[model samples]
Target: MTVRFELYSTWGCHLCEQAEQMLQQAGLSGQYQVLDIVDHAHLFEQYRVLIPVLACRHTKATLGWPFDQAQLTAWLQLQLQED
Candidate 1:
């Protein structure tokens, strides 16, 4: 089964942009969706200070920002195993 991911982010956030670029660089450009926190009140409240978070749609597992490609790969692997 294919596991999809959500990238929680907001516009004009440099770090968020970096996270997106990292995903693209990691060859995951088509594997995840970008969700703007500003459009969802609950998400906005929960991730207001945690934009750039990557979440597994199936497991609800999350990885916060400041993560590199290696960390992202490992996280995805772990999530796959859990699910």
Candidate 2:
């Protein structure tokens, strides 16, 4: 099963940058789509305070900022199970 992730974030956000680096370190960089909330009105509103969110498109699961490698891995596992 191929897992796809959507990273909701905006430019110049430190947390967003960290989240992206975590994804890269996890070897998930290619499987994710970076969606800049600033490009979409609804997305910006929905995730204004929740930037740096990692979302599973198939399961509709979301992980907010301040996550580490362990949390990201667990979140992915949970989302996979839900799918």
Q: What lDDT does the true structure give each of the candidates? A: 0.88, 0.88
State the number of backbone clashes in model 2.
0
Error of 1 at 10 (Å): 0.4
lDDT of 1 by residue, 1-83 (tens): 24388999999999999999987887776788999999999999999998899998888899998898899878878987986
Q: Give model 2's TM-score versus the native structure.
A: 0.89
Clash totals for all candidate models? 0, 0
Alpha carbon deviation, residue 23, candidate 1 (Å):
1.0
Model 2 per-residue lDDT tens digits across residues 20-82? 999888788578899999999999999999889999999887899878999998888887788
Error of 2 at 73 (Å): 0.8
Query: Against the true structure, candidate 2 has what lDDT?
Result: 0.88
Lowest lDDT 10-mer window, candidate 1?
A: 1-10
